[model samples]
Target: MSRTIDERIVEMRFDNRQFEQNVQTSLSTLDKLKRGLDLDNAAKSLDGLGDAAKRCDMSVLGKSVETVQAKFSAFQVVAMTTLSNITNSAVNTGKRLVSALTIDPIKTGFQEYETQIGAVQTILANTQHEGTNLQQVNRALDELNTYADKTIYNFTEMTRNIGTFTAAGVNLRTSVDSIKGIANLAAISGSTSQQASTAMYQLSQALAAGKVSLMDWNSVVNAGMGGKVFQDALVRTSELLGTGAQNAINMYGSFRESLTRGEWLTTEVLTETLKQFAGAYSEADLIQQGFSEAQARDIAQMAKTAEDAATKVKTFTQLWDTLKESAQSGWTTTWEILVGDFEEAKEVLTEVSDAIGGVISETSQARNELLSGGLSSGWKQLLDQGIADEGGFIESIQEVARESGDAFDKLVADSESFSDALKQGLTDGVVSSETLTQAVHNLREKMTGMSQEERKAAGYTAEMIEQIEALDKGLQNGSVSMEEFTEKILRPSGRENLIQAVWNAAKGLVSVITPIKDAFREIFPPATADQLYSLTE
Candidate 1:
């Protein structure tokens, strides 16, 4: 089996040469495959295999072969998939090129395209027959292509218009479907393709600018408020309300309903009504925040009359400033009278400032009754009743500062005794000689000399007695807050002290009997005082 050593060397050389030639052929095939496909790394791996084979090292050659095999397998799978995807589509080459080149499927009727020949082959393969019905099939395909061509032309033009907007940094994808739907609707509603695309662009711009929300855009489009009408509404609303226009759909609910019912024929009425509605709504809010009902109504009416957003905002600002200044001035005066110094009243002043600011900034109720009638009037009312103490003064102010909701109820329950005392005390000089004192004195004399049972018989209701008792009980037991008792019961009724209370009762009884005597005289013309008094008794 062993020939000469030289013979063995010759045989080995021949085999090495053949192996090198085979490696070169394999490398050539890989290079050709790389040119036809995107297999850069696979070709490089095969090149390395060729270099290894040239070295004639069996171990290195074996590893390179394994690597090349694995790479080739992956490359084959990718290549086959790519080729299949390209070949399986039912669109022509030109159309496929357009789709691929533009990266827009709407440009062509198909996402991927094939030729007419491929389509016929697909039909024949599916039917498992050839030459039969070929003409009919071609005719049907022709008709289909014609329809697809027109549709594609419209879609392509629309998408191009959309592209112009997207090019300006707009994100159409946010409402892509909605935009497409709108475009389609516009097309169907007798708008030219360019017109539909323009309208869609306007809507997209509105959505992007936050002048309208996606839902709002859809709502308008769905309601058939398309073309210039929808565009105008969006632009006008945004102009009128600024960012508030984002909620146009919700704000225009009634307007939309009217449109649906054929009640509103134009957007002008809708916009005007919306402006008025906004004004009224703002006015109502101001009223709740302490603006007098009259002032709020006037401000709202001004907003409507102005019909401009900036004007409305300016008017509101001015009104608010006026209210804030008035509140601050009023509170300042009350603070000065109550505490005698701003420094000493810092805490209360801060509270006052904050309350005023809150009414202006947050549109809260102003609670300005404490200062409305002027500090002098309030002081005269309190001082005339002889409070004379800082604590009593502050407490009286606070009671008046409370909301008016329950103040009148407390007043009705507590007024009678307070009123009577206020009348008699001022007349007798027990209280001050203020103007209120004279008024109280006259009221007290009017109720002089009457028994409780006689007063009851003279039409003083049981309910009135019950209320008076409840008020007395409330004050005695401290069930009623001092602020309430002072503002609602004391200040309003003009009663400053218990001495006034006794005087009020005395004056009340006298008033009842005197009224009875006078009425008895009136009933029996020219009756004497003694007869009238006896009849009353």
Candidate 2:
């Protein structure tokens, strides 16, 4: 059993091997005879087992979990470093602005600076919370969002207070607008406002091209950290501007002249707040973009495998349809007779489906075994607990396939062109493994009505199942790939090769390959194994 001391930790209490085997046995029995045990409950139990394993420090399963956690840790540290840099920049900039607020010999900039202080504070808070890993980052962002909502609200109140200073907002928006407009006319950037307008238009066009939808701007001040911030900024900016202007006016004996600077404070507030808002978005965007890039390669690889498997499933279904058509024609007088005519075609096809289903079930089991230590269990555990990023193409394909049957249809249709190109060698000569498999099942169904004697007369036999098992074994033992095995046993190799190629590449180190000769020998005899190998060569 290759039992290890690690397996004993927090040991399943139940016999580890016996319990797992029992679960599989019960699952198989249900699937074979009764069918489809609601796996969610069982999967949950498996995950609990994983957690237990981890707590006990069982090396076998613990190692797999630790590996995933380690990768997450690595990503986290890098992310934390990124956050640290951003935080330092924001903090330094903020303190300088604060100093300006305090040191303004005239005390004039204080009010406008006041509106922006919360924005900096909000950013600092978010930066403080953000972690390096996905889970932690997400939680931190959630907290940041709470803070942001308040910050934005603070700016919003500041805006309303500053709203009396529309002249200021207009001037600021105009300055930005003018530059953009001229840039649009210039086709990029220029010295003139007209050219700048062109640039503005171009930027607008670019924005329009992206098809963005607008969310209400006034949702601020309603709830959360954003509202609190806007409230703070609103009170402070307005108070500072009003107070500074009144003091300046009273001191300078110029009441009306103070309004211009007072109004200008509004512009200052809006501009600064907007920058912080954008910065918050920027910080989050940077992290998520990085995360996506990190995760993308694995996602794309899985998608590719899924695409290949879909084609195989499609080909099998298509071939079954063709066989159906063939049965209705001259070569085989009737559907019933055609089925019986092919000997054990009906049984063969059924076996193929059964075989594929079995593999799926077993793979699920093995994956569960590997990840038997974590919060995740069963399929989730296997998927989440991968030490190496490449999680077998089949696993990816199956994950994708679990989503929907339609994807396979598209894959199959796309493969037709490839199949046609290698028609003799791959398409016609090689035959899709899925198609042949489904064909055998179809044959079984088609032959079902026939009596025992008729089935024998038709040429059907149990030998085919034996042959398939032999092939499966070969593939399992690192003997021959699905491609080579399919190419030898079935014609029209396109789907098989595509699947094998993807499986090998996508899985990287996970595939269990079997020798072709030994594979066939398992089904037939030692001699037949060599013969099959030689034939494929």
Candidate 3:
């Protein structure tokens, strides 16, 4: 045993030679295993232990190489079993980690929240272009939406119509009333908010252009039903002229006013007009009278068949009468009671809307408080079983993961520090080298005897336990010396000793690295070694 300092250098050189030979042989065996060789046999066999046994001369050691190979082969089996268990555990844990991250509840909730805000922004942008204030529009929408929710109306439809009504110069109160009226119309007439808005807008244009008298407009409004019949007449006349509504309104000037005075809109008057156009004049004559060819053909064909004309007339008359009855009865009395009047409804709605808005805001603030770290740990625990926002669940999970990672790191750091201290004790003569070597050997044997579960409970990861076993084996088998272990494994940062080691190692390995550096200084640079080792500390 090379216990004296004089024999230490020779032992180190011999260990280095053996370690290099073992590493080369192991790498070659692993390469063969990677290429689809029989992995179990290759891992267990000692035939791949390299030519060290032959070159070192087995007679001198007094043991045949096969006997040593058997022992090494058993260690390999134990090490491989430990590694396989660790890999399986890591894969299962990784699957759980991925599952937790992929379906993050808070992330999904925030995405939905952002989508709702985006839709609101789009509505606001569209409403703002029509000279309505965004705040006013949003407030009206909330109030009308709440009101609709309490009634038979669809909240989404009413909310949409409120924005449209406000943009078209309707006050918030009238907008709500109009939404109610339109919703009722939709129920009775199956008209959508889009169609109602177009009809109302066309009526406004007709009023603005003096085509329909103010009296007619008020009659349409005070009836508390959408003017679907009146608007359809205008649309039909426009179609007859092969033109848009505005152009039709402009060209005819007082067409709606004339219709209101007579009954160009009533069933009797429309039938009379169609009868006169049916056969009293040619298609050319109707066209000369400003009717399109398609319109003349339709009129002439309708009048040609008495049954066709009568059926069409009765259908039109029944539709008009049904709408008239719906306008008079459907929700009109309820609308009058709820609103009292349009002007009064505005004041009432504004006050009620503001109150409801306050309640909504308070509810939202309370929810935000619970999510924004305001709750106690006990409350948080209970709340975590349900929905949580980004500020709550994600933050909590991230903090726990960070703490677990930090704890694992500390465990590894403590084990490394303890090993380093043991090596340092031997160097300082606080313990004899024999005592340190025996201690390492005993630790390795104890660790190897434990099951994988027992090692895990003792805070030893697979990598840490594997390193301890391999280093002890190298020491006991004369494959690695204490000097190599100290220099490579411990890599001590004691300044003077580190500088000496670097200088000695550099002299042997990099003596001819640079001709200029060699000529300028035969010694390694202390400045470079200090700079390089500073990072370790």
lDDT of 2 by residue, 1-537 (tens): 336655765476558877889999998887865435667778889999999977885676888899999999999999999999999999998886555434431232233223333333332333334322333322332332232222211212222222222222232233222222222212211122222222233323323233111121121111111233332332333343353534644554543344323332243333323322222223344335442443334333333332232122234433443232222222222222434322244466578889999999999988765544322222232223221222232333333333444444344355654223223323343334443333333333444556778758765455633443444344457563444434433342344566778888876644434465567778886456778899999
Candidate lDDT scores, in order, read: 0.45, 0.38, 0.49
Please report, as a residue range, the 10-residue window in candidate 2 with the lowest summed lDDT.
212-221
Give RMSD (Å) of candidate 2 vs. truth: 45.9
**Cα lDDT tens digits for candidate 1, 379-442:** 3443433232334233333233233344433443555744444334334444332233232333
lDDT of 3: 0.49
TM-score of each: 0.16, 0.13, 0.19
Model 1 TM-score, 2 decimals: 0.16
Cα miss at 280, model 3 (Å)? Answer: 50
lDDT of 2 at 524: 80
Q: After superposition on all CA atoms, how large is the RMSD of candidate 1? A: 38.7
Winning model by TM-score: 3
Candidate 3: how many backbone clashes? 0
* Ranking, lDDT, top scorer first: 3, 1, 2
Q: Which candidate is the best by lDDT?
A: 3
Q: Against the correct fold, how does model 2 do in TM-score?
A: 0.13
